[model samples]
Target chain A: MDTIDNLADNQPKLVGHDHVAQINPLLPLRKWLYSWLFDPGIPGNHQKAVDRWISILIVANLFALLFEHVDVIYEANKHWFHWFDIFSVAIFTVEYLVRLYLAPEDREFGGKKFPRLRYISSPFAVIDFLAVAPFFLQAVIAVDLRFLRSLRLLRILKLFRVLIPACRQFVKVNAGRTFRQKVHALVFAGEYGGTLHNIFDMFIALWVVVSVVAVVLESVQTVHYVLNLQFVILDAVAVAVFTVEYCMRIYSCVEEPGFQRAVLGRFKQARTPSVVIDFLAILPFFLEVFLHHLFDLRFLRVFRLARLLKLTRYTSATSTLTRVIVREWPVISAAAFVMLLLVVLTASLGYLFEHEAQPDKFENIPQSIYWAVVTLASVGYGDISPITPAGRAMTIILALLGIGIFAIPAALFSAAFSDELTKEREKLKRDLYEMLADGVISPDEAAIINREARRLHLRQNEVDHMIEKARNDRESVADLSGLPIHRIAAKPEHAIEHYKALLGQIRQLGILTDGLQFEQLARQADRLTSSELALWRQIHGNHQSQP
Target chain B: MTDTPEQSGVPLALAPALTLADMSFLVFLAAILMAVVWLGRIAYLEGVKTEVTKASGEAWVQWFTEASPKRFTPGFEPSSCAGGASPAGTNGKSAGSDAGASVNPVPERLWEGCLESLMKDVEPIAGLRNPFSGKPLMFAAKCDTDDRSLVGAMVLEKLTPTPPGSAVAYTTSSLVGADIIERKLQLRVTVCDKGAYPIRIAEVEF
Candidate 1:
């Protein structure tokens, strides 16, 4: 107790009483309230209160979506709908304000100086503002359209913020150590790395800005607006910014890391699937902006969506999907290529067969190709067709090919899904083993294992057996007398006496003489006996507790 | 390639045992049903392809736009071509009178004929030459009590033959003495032909 007290006195209290004392009285009260409201780890009752409120808010929004479609409901009880909206808006606004009030000072905009501006600038605060602003803005701005109230649907984004804590737990469980280690190393790669990263990041930001500006200019109603000029300007700016960023990234790597070294190292270090994704993200932008014509530029937008794969770095599920895709790439790629070949062949045949008889339908090779593509993919738009009998037969064949092509991806996913489930089960088994290492499973730990096993669709008996084995192996040195046993009378008196005599003989042989050693041996013997009894009970289906 | 209608030595005649009116009506009905079936087939095929393409990872919009132009059979051209001519003739008798009589006499056509008959009978003094054939014409009137049918009068103008085709102007006026009556009137006018067969009196109306 004295030693424990000494250790406690020596330990640094980074966020203990001193930190609480440092906080202004008013600020501390606000922080306490915020934690009370939002903190998930609050003692049982308050946590339940928070969960109930969140559920109520979710249910309210869902009800609003449903009710918004029912004009009669609104007409019959107009006040009810308005009141629901007002209540939700009020609760969200208060929560947003409390968060702003309790935000750490350093994180607030302008630190301590411009508190109001700081509060307004936060993202959640902006969400709160947007959620309620449209209603009042409608009143002040004299916009009277009832349908405009639907913009309140933007409040759905706030649900994403609510999901963040759950996503954090999911991410911690799924991300491999290699990813964490690489991120740590990259962070420490110093000024050059930082500058290069910043340049690429800035380029992306600038591209987004230019794209938005172009969209706005294109949408303008004025006769003087020139869409071609906006497109040209957007193209030029994107090219210029991307070129600079790429050049800087290339140049910086040339010094310490060496260009090839940096590139190879980064490639080698990247989690296998991300390397391909990273290449795809940058390649399209580089090709379109620096090397291609405007007509070809639009195709790059497809690759821009691929840039979303970079979110794998932040999203565990996406990363796990990427890993699964990589592991099964050979099969997937083979299937994909086969499907592509089939599409091309079918389209070519369709064009040939349908061209002469149905000139309008298969006017040219490309037109027939389109029909073949749709047919093979099973879209069958029915706009064009083969008027000839042979052409119809070919279409039938193409439709069958489409089914096969569609099934390939599904099969690949099923295989990968099962593999993932198996891996999760094994991980649960390991966790159960660790928890049961002290020779007994706590009720809480057992409950968690049961829940996880059920979630993974694993047999509970298998998990229990693994845990018992681990426990017995870990407690091989423990005293046996205090150990819980239910089957003391299962062994006859003569057998018990014989076993006791054997144990004495073993001790006399100097193999297990010390008390700790004797205890370990006894525990091992107890584990062996219990395991045998467990197996016997399992087989017989009639064994019960004897103690 | 050698299977030409001209080489077959069978004259291509405008005359048939069945009147041109019956043939035209049948053709019109057939055309409408064909169009509906064509559209329906295309729509069904397109719907199936759309669902299949979506399942195969193709974007719905891209697949739809790309497939639309290729989804239909080409429109068939008419087997025979004829030059356009004005539907009116000299002596206030219109070519539409003959063509209308050849087709089904729907209510609209009968009403138009009635209006034309009234105009001609009221203004019999006003006459003009047939614009294509350049033939002078006068009104013709015929009513026989032996047949209880009321027939409108028709005027016949001269026929002028051209290098490629010939044009003729004709009119029929039949008197309808009864308050309520259904009547059939027929007029026949023939013209010389250059490349194709000679024009025959296929069918006509008063």
Candidate 2:
């Protein structure tokens, strides 16, 4: 026992030499490079920046590869494309070489014999190699031009560096969750969808725009003449994607609270306006394909423009506008009724005064109604005019009345839209406050905040400012007298809420108290169960040691 | 009733000018493409600079050590090295003892300069430029061994027009004993354009 104690006392201490590796000068840099190139699990803002940058480069490379297929774009911007390729190749090459150099530092590679060789053989390294190999390969050998392009596409595989980890994280997050839940996460904006969901939404939105543009351009004779086949192919692809999306939404909508009923719930979802729009967006292509011979279904192509409405589903302003319209429906309808009554009375008066003088022009009340409408709307076509003095005087009075009557609905909608948008923004602020109440934003809560901000058309910095404000508000409220936990806990219905509040207060206390005093207070507390006390101590210790 | 319908009263001038819309769409699409490419180029260059600056000396040393022959060290002089290791020499026999001993590694930093010097030796049969911008070109070369023979591959790039001292191109050329003696220094030049994707433009003997 004495020997053991003596040995312990004599042992070399790491206090002063904890970072002895720092003496090598290049150790930190080597470790940092190793972290970025090989081990994404290592935490650093620089690695994330590098990953984001590489992902962007991969996307840009894919874009460049795609644009190269378009002869006109490639021809006009040949040098830009060339310079970009050189730049991409340079970066990718550096990345590949750096990764190769740093492979021996990786946990998986470092423990093995011939670590660099093993790294070279790894699947990711192979992808990295293939990404740069073609650029060099084409330079040396006479590669088939078609084959070379296909080879260039291998650069997309480099995205696995970002994608694989994201996928793993997604899977780990959703493990033991139901398939319906997974599908729901993918289709809807919430905790489950993550970055993949964002990508999926972006893809769908892109297709919507593409299909709509194709429809518009197809109407142009010259463009239709040249790109008729392309338009057809694009429309078909867009329809397929929408069809799959529609099916997925219907299938997984049961995961939603209101739509929990299995079959009937799906029916309810299918009846939703956005879902109907989604159905209509893809229906034209199918109708044309199946029913083309039955009738001149060429007119149905106009409905392809309905795809643009799909974008409204991704944004909140449309839903807010719908709410405003619904809320102000009565006033708008009354204004419409007044406008209708005035139009009919104006038509009658115009016909009575001008019928004898301009029988051919005023001909009948219905014809005069057209003139009345044209004048009322302030869109005078000059196609008709009342000749008599009484008729001219009536026309002037009616046009003046028309302007005021027509402005009522416009004014109402403008006011209501503004009011509704403000309310929605306020609601978002409330949600942000609730999120910051706990003093930390979970990934799921952050995603919800992000979605809400985007729906409100709030810029990223604006969302960040709101979050900061919410945090500040919470901090202010965290002052000694701001919230009473015992009073909050008095209501049995709010047991969980009170429990969370109590925990938060404890955490705050843990932050404020000295380590030894806090530990003593925690040990002396009898209210906490053993497990609860252990958890609190752990939390307290971690919080105190964070700096 | 007649089978043919009567034409409308609207004149051709009043009809929608599809040509104008199509032209505008094309212009819009082109502008977007150019913008994306321009932004991508700027971002990629910046990213590379940041990453490279962060991992500078040791990273390069490790990379070059793994990639190329030891002779291509930091202070290598291609003029002295290549001259000593003559193309006529087979493992330094034809080039005698003194010339063989003089053959040393080419400088890693001056690899591009080495290529430039080698290019000057080659008769100027053709000039390379960016076909679109008509700008002067620089090349990125890599040295490797294929079937026990020394080979160099060069990717020709148009130097970026803005921000001077950006887009520095480098090359590494391997010089094997028997291969250098037996074969011409094959410099397979590929122009960075889709149309020139299949190019093997130069094969110079030194």
Candidate 3:
């Protein structure tokens, strides 16, 4: 046991020496090279490399496709292209081998001699295989039309995974900054303040816009011939890709051991507002692909453009806006429901009042409701108008309600924004108090606080003053009180009403406490007895009298 | 309502003025090319930089070890002795040589440099002889290998272009029958182990 302990004690030193010896020769040069190839915090280098390789492969595949058509190039360079395909296959094969070699041993299936198959079955590995598979398939399969290389375009999707990690990190860092802006917008729209929910609404809006445009564009008879089978194919492909992505995300989360503990936990972590946006954006595509065959729903294909909402995932501001919409959705929905009910009631009244006078325009309640919708939406098409005096009066009243309904989203958004800010402030207060209890603050911690404050747009001086006051208060009561009075005041109920306001302040100061001792505060609280409480009350009464 | 020759039949020759459909197809093709070019440029810049840096770093490591020997004693600093034959070597090569031997004496780097030099020497002839990019040329030849009598036999030639600046060139030749055309100025032929009596040519004209 002593020998083992002694060996363990010397192990790290020996390893360090070994590393120094091995790395010393290459250190200066390797450092320079590493610095050139990889930026310290930039997480996309590997992905970038993979993306480049994929691009090369795609281009090669495309050239192969083009070569088939241009006989001059094809006849002259047939042998060359064939050789190029072989080289690509060889490179891919080697890559597959290396990946199998590098992959975790446990993941190697059935302890088989041929581990490449196992590797290819993995998600990323499958993508890698797909990158090169189309060409190989074309080489072997005797198909009438050699259009399989078009499938090679799917390799572009792999780039998404490569960019995802970096993009996600970027979003995480900037999400807080944009959260307030989005919340304000949502409140102004009379929607919820959750960034994710707001994003969902934006996605819906995008879908509506895209569908309308598609329908409008399709309506033009001159261009209808141009829109052929390819449009349907594109829609189908888009739906499949999104559905696959959604399924994988959900499956990955559910398969995680921790996620199995709670169903909502999986949804909370996996069903991000962006993910919801992704689902909804692609939903129209799926609807068209599946339903178009069953019925004459070809016109609905225009809705597939709704997928543009997926762009929200790429921008922090948009994502935060989406969250705000989600947070305030229930309230906004309630308000909308009320507005809808009013529109229906008023439409019926208008139909009764105006149908006799303007038979062509207000033929039925449905037609009247359509006009009411356009008016309420602030989009008076001018095609339909009420001529009767009573009808005109009702129209004026309905227009006023439409304007009110338009303002509801904005009102809801403001309320939700305030709530978000409050939660953020409370969270900051808790974090600050906890840090103070740790009895130490590092520069990095300070920098973090400062950044946070700047992000929150708080007054730096005020935050500094607050942090100083807390620190001083903590120091003064360090010995006798065992816990600071300010720490007690920093509790959620006692802290500032606006969580964001406090967080902003804390961030500006960059105040961080390392190894905070919140357990000590709990212990101190445990020490408080009923007698002490009574004594505190008596002291408070005495103080009040003096004041 | 009748299917006219103009509507149903293939054009014997491409027209000078492109139709809208043809133009659209060309535009799509150009877009694909542009995307590929953009991606390729980024990848090439990054990949080449990374590879060059790695190579230079290894070279530096080799230079350092040659300059300072006593400072990096075996077992004292195993990592510094990497690329050497000793157990301390971690330069990715198997360690089983004398410690005093020259470090990083492997032939892989030499072979790669030779290949690159060969490629650069013959690059100009590439466009004239083989118009297609390097990848497809390699792919097609391998696919049609079985059609030839000699299944595994192939020839690779390193063709040096006239007045080469810094481009790689190669001509690959394969023989199947008397009618088959074998030699071209563009492709570099490295090996000819496939078939007997392959036809030879100087260059290909479009």
Predicted structure with the largest TM-score when compared to the true one: 2
DockQ of 2: 0.01
Question: Model 1: per-residue lDDT, tens digit, A30-51?
Answer: 5556445554443322433554
Residue lDDT tens for model 2, A1-547: 1111122243222122112222333557877667544465543324666777897799889878876876656888999999999999999999888878888788878878999999999999999999989889989999997798899999999988877866765665565465666668789876667667876787799789878888898787545534444565566567667877887788779888799897899999999999999999877766655563354466798999999999998777787878988999999999999988988898899899999999998888998899989999889999998889998888888889889998899999999998988888888888878865655565456556656766777775676577668765764455423345453344454456556666788888876768666555556775556687678767666544321
Model 1 C-alpha lDDT versus the unseen true structure: 0.47
The weakest ten consecutive residues by lDDT in model 2 chain B span B1-10
TM-score of 1: 0.33
CAPRI quality of model 2 = incorrect
Deviation (Å) of A82 in candidate 3: 26
lDDT of 2 by residue, B76-176 (tens): 33332332333332122332235554474321122333345434542221243332233333333322222111111225222212455556443324333
Go through the candidates in order and give each one's C-alpha lDDT: 0.47, 0.63, 0.47
- What digit string (tens of lDDT, one per residue) describes model 3 on residues A309-379? 56544344464456678988889899988888988997898889988898988889998888888877778
> What lDDT does model 2 reach?
0.63
TM-scores, one per candidate:
0.33, 0.53, 0.33
- The TM-score between candidate 3 and the true structure equals 0.33
Name the 10 consecutive residues with the lowest summed lDDT in model 3 chain A.
Answer: A14-23
